[model samples]
Target: MQYDFDKIILRNGTNAIKWDGLDKTFGAADILPMWIADMDFEAPQPVIDAVVNRAQHGIYGYTEKPESFYSSISNWMKKRHGWQIDNKWIEVSAGVVPAISLSILSYSEPGDKILLQSPVYYPFFSAIESNNRVMVNNQLIYENHQYKIDFNDLESKLKTGVKVIILCNPHNPVGRVWSREELEKIGELCIRYNVIIVSDEIHSDLIFGKHTHIPIASISEELAERTVTCMAPSKTFNIAGLYTSAVIISDDTLRGEFKNTMNRLNAEAKNLFGIIALEAAYTYGEEWLEQALPYLEGNLDFLVDYFITKIPNIKVSKPQGTYLAWLDCKELGMNQKDLVDFFIHKA
Candidate 1:
């Protein structure tokens, strides 16, 4: 336990969206902001050291991602997730959303269809519709307070000519880590229908008890060919402001298409500090993560207990992955506005 998670870090005036943007976004300076994904803690010291070292070097120049960058990613994937990746398979983007947006541009024509699972990361809707692609949601099945993929519905959507499907591994909001079998089903479906899979796996590293995140690409070579697996240290290491993410496309043609799209917009290169911070994180942040996860799980346990004991009316779904807790606000009988008001004003 080298790092402390219980200490509340004051973030006011730090320009942090979670803390500083509260007044601007919610029209009040006093509401405790918990809507965003970023954590309230500081990054591990090694990541801080790397960024500070880069800053102190005083040469802020355009830089290319070196071979070590690829090595760190490859090694991390191999050691942590049991997936071996070639350096050639990796590509850089500012963030996962940007990578998905680029995936939309690279793989599909305007007016084509893209598929997603809902209630998913809300940005998937924007990434599809913003790029003039039709958004198709294969609504998830929520039974007994757990989310399961509706394979029949997903297959039905693919039949409508979905060119791409964005997967949120260890899914956002509702945190269910897709099992290997689940990924196999998804991969097989994409192969059968020729739908390219764009997996937004930014939350992959934050998995919880008895849940493992199998990269949809790692399920098989064919799946890898059709899948663009997007990941970042930003979520795991709390560095989203750095704007760094990795997009892995195993097929040569798909990789070339993605690289071309990035080149056209000069988005291939990563931010200088992001580059250093990412390498440091993947290489040295494992120890910090081992400690951070239990703290997160403990936090969830605390919330569940507190709710049952003190606020018996509220129900929360304990997450299998990610720090997010999806609360069932239904018992309060609040509409959308009422829900927002209750969180902001009532409790």
Candidate 2:
């Protein structure tokens, strides 16, 4: 059950976007890819074995998700996060980013205002703007070397006919595992403003230290009814290429609309290997994750301490969850262009 997370794996020749496509993405092949969210470790052995076993059957066809797929998700949510969900609440998606677009299509119209916390995951910006929706920002406040939700700004934005707000629980880039109190405040505002919450909980499994990731919907039944929570085994198991994710919607009408969007987009068909890997990951990858978390935590600690000791000008925001870190390089006295050059050409 002990996973060797310290073992370095070569991903260069593989079609991994994080490694193989770096030259095309960053304009230099030599640049280290610390940008993409996918991890550098190998997936859980059980997941690999399950996919290999499935591939050995020697038939690739349109695959239907088995009952085990639904059960694995439902059970994993209940056991890991203490969030009880019915199998019926689960809907299929290839990825969380795509699911976000689907939710925007399902619940809001073109030109409808959608809110986001600034400095969030970049794709969130694209999901709203590309769909022709008005993008609104309620930027997070940075104080005392940490990030905090600007609840006042959030509430003010929500009041402006904002039809949807995409919340990043255990927020990306900034790395705040939202507390229950913060989630409740967001829930209360959404309820008051009649805005739907599309919560991206993809990083829920990778929390660190004393911080617990509370699924925003789990706080209250009222919150659950309006929240469309997107999650996947992809990030937890480093299977992002497999492209399997789930959208859990408790409200019957909301679920139906999301399903309708999926059907309209012809996106309900699950990937053959993705399904096998997902089921294996949720059912048997916990021990692998239990090991990976400590490794990740150790990595975070090293990064933070290294910055303090060696790279004094670059302050690191020690995350409460997820492997991603937010680095502040303002004290280095570089402009945006200089910073890009420093990381790409010098660092």
Q: Which stretches of candidate 2 lie over 4 Å from their true place?
A: none
lDDT of 1 by residue, 1-347 (tens): 48888878888888888888888888887887888999988899999998898899899998878899888998989888999999999999999999999999999999999999998888889999999999988999988879999999999989889999989988998989998888899888898999999998898888888888788888888789888999899999999999989898899999999999999988874589999999999989999999999999899999888988888777777888888887777788889998887788777
Measured against the true structure, the TM-scores of the candidates, in listed sequence, are 0.97, 0.98
Deviation (Å) of 197 in candidate 2: 0.4
Model 2 poorest ten-residue lDDT run: 1-10
Candidate 2 backbone collisions, by pair: none
| 1-347 per-residue lDDT for model 2 (tens digits) | 67887789898898888888878977899888998999989999999999999999999998889899999999999999999999999998999999999999999999999999989999999999999999999999999999999998888889989999999988998889999999999999999999999999999999998999999989989999999999998889999999889899999999999999999899874899989999999999999999999989999999999999999989987999988999999899999999998999999
For model 2, what is the error of residue 125's alpha carbon versus the real structure, in angstroms, after optimal superposition?
0.8
lDDT of each: 0.89, 0.93
Cα deviation at 9, candidate 1, in Å, is 2.0
What number of clashing residue pairs does each candidate have, in the order they appear?
A: 0, 0
